[model samples]
Target: MKRTTSSKRCNYVLEKLKLHYSGTSYCNCFEPPWLCPEVEECVWKPESNKSKQFTNAVNTWIDLSKKTNNLFIKKQLYEWLDMNHANILAVDRGLYPVERFFPLEKKGIFNTFLGRIIMEILPPCKNTKGKNKILHLLSKACPKRCQIRNLKEIVLQYATEDDQTYLFLLEVMKKSLLGKYNHCKVQLQFEGRHVFYQMFSYQISQKSFFLKWFENGNHQIFLFFCLKEYLCDAVRQVKTVYDYIEKHWKWSIFDKQVVKSMDNCRKILNTISEREYNLLHVSDWISSIESFLLQVSKQHIKLFRTTNAMGYISKLKVNLNKYIISEDLNVDIRQDVSRFLWEITQRTTDKNVFYYALEVLGLEREVVEKVKNEIFCALDYKMLSPNDLFTLKEFCRVIELHKSTYNFVLPKHYYDKQVLSLKKRENKNNQAIGYICFICNDIKFFLTKLSDSSRHSNKLARGSLRVVVDNDISCCHENNLKFVCGKKPERHVKNSKKKWKNDKKALTRKLLKEKQRNFLSKQCIQTPLQEIDLLGHAIQFNNKMIMLCSSCGNVCMLDPESFKYSVNINCKVCHVSPRDICIKCNTETTCNKILVYNQRRTKFHKAPMCNNCTNVYAQKQPVVI
Candidate 1:
């Protein structure tokens, strides 16, 4: 042992040599097959060596760049996978080559490029560990320092030409990292890629993870993504239509129409997208596609119907109201029916249904005319009420009303505010051009005079009031011309002989107070025979005393003695008229019987007049026999 070169290699190097030797057993024809370790022993790794297989897989994909044909194939393959060409070459050249991370005592695989490649190599089968294995490989792909931009590059490199693979990768990422990190930001290379990433629930993940994705954006991307697996072909078709609409449709005019029309398409997408695991039956997909197309067709019909109606009306150069209203239009409907229709129109949400109901009742013309008049009155006065505008909107949905007719009409307060704004703008322009309000000019002249009067009072005179040169006629006069009073504190006075002070003055004040009390007491005196009238007050009209009724504006002569004695004067015309006149014939009539108007004893006339005049007052008041 002293003379011999007794050297020992590290256990790791020894194991590695053994592994390499076992792998090359087929290369050595002279070697005994039984002497070589099994294939499992050669490739299989312990928990301590989890990244060994992961590194081999990544190296297998990464080493392809050594050959030109394989490199070209790899480039084109990744390009079709919705990956940037430059990114592939950079990773292939080891400029940010596939990285492997392993925890000190954890049992997880590497997150290298071929770790993702192994997913396609080992597709899902009856094996339960398939998902766990896929996730185990992808768990550590992103390092602690990695952000969304780099994450996009790393994750997208693993994408394949197949859409299902990208979707599956997204699913795996969503399940694994979604809990740890809310979402990842993925920027597409180009438009029309049929990739919708915003719609995914990445927002529901951890704020720290999402913030990292959201904050670091080296690229621009659209929001709202979708991963359509079921009815994928139908979704593509819908996407084509959506692109056309988005590009060509006049958004201002057709925004609501487009949104309404595509509701069914959105529902279809949502239904298909909910199935994370691809185990749906063919019948299910077919049924979903059929309903989706059916809904789309229905919405299409609705949109076409509305647009065609609009176009026809536009070409005719007439309004919906003009079409409905006519000189010869007969509105001979029942009063109750008209009332009912008005109530229904106010309450009805669906304008089309309301219009249809109006058409069925043959009252569309009357209703349209009424609504048109209300809208005109509201708009002309700029009424602050939204009731009429709401009615117009509800009616417009059924009749395809033009925006020009109703858009200019604002609520009363808003209209006034805008008018005031315009006036203020005009005033500003006037001020800028050296024009000023007359009141402001007058104040300026007065201030100059005051300043000239006292040289030292110039600043004080100028500081008295702020002058705004608004030339608007509606500007408040009081606002511009205000008087500022100086504050003066009252001086305290003390009298030593309080009892001997001003005896004559006190006696005069007491006599005045007694006279005032006597005058009011005499005016307030009332007799027992005099009836009280609560609704009327005495007034001197045309130099004569008269009792004025507040409720009905009737006046009656009051006797001087009654006026002095009565606390409240009663109107003879309203309370007890001297005579009654026939209402229909306008002639004096005699009373036959009293006509009761209602259960309450409140009659049309307050005085005992001819009951035949009941028809005159109550307009044919029926007598209760």
Candidate 2:
């Protein structure tokens, strides 16, 4: 067993080295693994012998090395040097090794939470950059009597106001906040010391300052930065859960594929313990982030606008080597790369319920493609993004003054937006057969699960399922259909009116019908859909019996006008609140989902906050729903 393991390690290292050395003279960021830093210190350490240990391997490595004739590679490993000293020894390879840059206190532990917090936030820190700089400041700048609890205050105390170190430390804090909860912020108060002597002796969170950010606080510094990161992460998780539930609700009502996937997710959520869920969540996030980083590495961009592209290129190469992207079905590499390069100047769902449900239930589709389309919709909706604006401005600038004929002009609709984007025009096109009829394309699958009878034809309790679009030959094909309801709305109808009149007569009629039917309060009024049905009184003569709108998820209704069979389907499903009703005032809020419940069909509420609460809590204090 030991020999076999040793052989595998040797082969792995050899393969990496082969790839590293095989690349061109111009490209050589990929290199050998690091040897033990204390190899010289330990008496038990074997002599630096490379050639004799792997005589056969060194010949191949040297041959590959000579082909490159790269100066960087030459400097690292000279021809005259002993092969043993040049080659890496994989003596202590582990899945994740524990290494620390900062020394332990006399008691053999990280003395304060500050150090540990810093270490935890900035990951893969084989280099002591964070620890070295932090330690250097803390060593002399920190007061012997009392250390400031705040990282910002501590920096200000030790360094001048204009020092760049403050910026660097801030960057570190920002990095630490990555993949953390949005609601993790905490506020700390210490009076009379004037930043110099203030220590994090008294800490308060935005939710409850009395409640410490971490489970434990052994530091004098308040570690408010740390708490803030965790809070952001918490808020993010809560929001994700809410979005998942909302999506599930929609799937249950409309899409058969999504319904089955959501059901599986529900079963998993119900069966699993909290510990398993936490593990799954962590796994999901890690995979998402790593995948993102790997995807970013594949593209070439005007990187960070540094004067010396060489250094940036070298760093980019190193990062690429570290986060290598292999062939994957689950990941749409092109889309991920495009998003990192062109679109994602803002946040989108990293791995939402849609993807997660499919992933856990072993259902396969182009899930990444679905996510990409969603991201595209989000980016286009904000209308001429800064990036888009800049590109347009720069293009025009060049055309006018620079005498460059790139001949790249913005699309006509890009400026006027005369043509509706797919997200906006989701309701009118369904060239496919059942799509025109407002039913699932895979009706056969649903039929297999349920007995074929007239009673169960409209399977859902309230409304029958149907495609969201109809009679647009331009969008009949699958390719056209996929993109159809994905366009951004031309303009937000801020005060969109309800179809019915606001008169006493209308109200009385609505109330009478509401009493006749066992109507739910928050439910969409049946009057509009009923009106749509009433429009086409028995006039369906073999075009296809239609029931729902697949494009905009509208069902059994006259979309734009009442009593008109020719009315083009207008999807209002996009306008419905994402069940984010504020708990305090029952108003729908934006992505505010701190509270969660297991039961289905309960109107999920949102949390509200005032400006004052925001200062006390981070970023609009998310009230518990």
- lDDT score of residue 403 within candidate 1: 23
lDDT, candidate 1, 18-103, per-residue tens: 44334553222111121322233121112243334332332232232222253333332222222222222333334542322111
Index of the highest-TM-score prediction: 1
Name the best candidate (by lDDT).
Answer: 1
The RMSD of every model to the true structure, in order and in angstroms, is: 37.1, 28.7
lDDT of 2 by residue, 1-625 (tens): 2445334444454454445545443222222322112111121122344322232233333333444465443322322111232122221121221221111011111133343333332222123243544444433221122222344445444334333443333333322322111221211111111110111122221223322322233222223322223222322344553355335333122222222222333233223322332242322222222233234323312111213234322333232222221111121122222223222222323435423333333322443343334332333312433333223222222122222111123233321221232234343232212211100011211111112222333222332232232235572443332311111112123332253447777655554444322211111111111112311121121222232332333233321222232233322232333343444455333333343332354544434433333344454333333
In model 2, which regions exceed 4 Å deviation?
Answer: 1-625
Give residue 386's lDDT in candidate 1 (0 to 100). 31
